[model samples]
Target: MIGRRILLAAGVLFGAAAFAQAQIDNGLPGPQPLDAGSMILNRTLFEGIMDRNSKVRSASAKPMPAGGYLSYRASSKVRQKVTREYLARAEKAYGKPIAEGLRKTLGAIDFVATWRRLATRDGLRTGDLGDSVTAYWAVNWLVANGKENSAPGQMQALRRQLGPLMASNPGVRRMSEAARQEVAESLMLDTVVLAIGADTAVQKNDPAVLAKLRTTTNDRFKQAFGIDLTTVTLTNRGLAKR
Candidate 1:
């Protein structure tokens, strides 16, 4: 009976893998010629990191208020170690720059996961919107730049994979429409930033294109979010110089 049960479980696992591969072969959506193998490997690595973080967080939970702060610190250390190991493996598999982008992208995924957990464990608060916006920005930057140059179809695959993860998190559904709009606008701004950043050669040769992108992004942000991204950019640059 045990042998039969083991065989049944193996078959289920095989079937699931086959179904995922079939999805890749069919090219569900967004970009073409997907690197399914790399996607699978990266997804596995990403999931492992998230799983380790969750486990560490659960293990470090304390009953006392003072112990709670200590537990948070301990969990953070474990998360950092897990992130480093996975990121290093990613860098080895993919080049440094691409891996750096993936680090931000996957980190965004983890952030969303954590937010979702927090919202569920405790009721949603206004502060959650800020965290969600930040995650959306990082994801947008990686996805937009990735679609244009680095690992084109792979980002789409990653995004697709992330959908189910997000859907499973109840907090996402509870977010207000206005907060969601802020997240969307943040993503749009980041997309523009990446497009401008990626065109190093063009920027060096023309210089005008960079100005054009800046103007365009500024206008778009103003129209969409009613905020001045140009001023924000300039202010950030000024601070960096100092």
Candidate 2:
């Protein structure tokens, strides 16, 4: 079910730098203060924590223990680099006008609203970022149509449009090719998880399709986070609760 997928993905992100921000953004409401060790506990939110852990364990150098959210001081540096690199690349590839638009517009708001707003805006309708703008349109479409669980093809279409669009931006491309790689990686994971959940919910309520996808849907929980699906809970039950 969509609910299960959201839980699993959310669980997978439990301890990353953006996890707390995501939690609040997802409507959890209110911040829960974290003690120092609590940050370490969040390492599972990230996959490379193990690599950090191995280094900490074997080397005489004492790096912070892994497995916490943004607690690794390194992530702060990494995130800044990403934003700066992307901005610089975007500025160069897109030119001053479009780059400023992206920074002032796209960067200013949350993802969902940004996409939807772009789709409706006249000024954003044109430019080097057109493909990215269209990609967001597609995202908003899939989400609004409730085909969130449709298939990979939907996401593929968005990728197809946005990938080249992103590439076309010299500023964005100036950063190593890895910048696009990172965005694609994170987006793919996020989309697949959410789509699976939406698709599950749709199929779940359908008698015939439900039977076929029930097992597949059940396993999506683990597929998303590697954790038992039953253990995690969602406050919103998959959809934004009314």
Model 2 spans > 4 angstroms off:
1-140, 148-164, 203-242
**Looking at model 1, which ten-residue stretch has the lowest summed lDDT?**
233-242
How many residue pairs collide in each prediction? 0, 14
Per-candidate Cα lDDT values, in order, are 0.31, 0.31
lDDT string for model 2 (52-166, tens) is: 3333423222222211211112133433444455445545544565445434432443333333232323222212222332333343234333333323223333333233333
- The lDDT, on a scale of 0 to 1, for candidate 2 is 0.31
Model 1 lDDT per residue over 1-242, tens place:
00000111233333222322222233212110112122123434444534443334232232112111111111444345445654565456445764466465444445323333322222222223232332332232222222222122222222233333333434544434443333333332233223323333132455554344345434433343333433221111110011
Least accurate 10 contiguous residues by lDDT in model 2: 233-242
Q: Tell me the lDDT of model 1 at 131.
A: 26
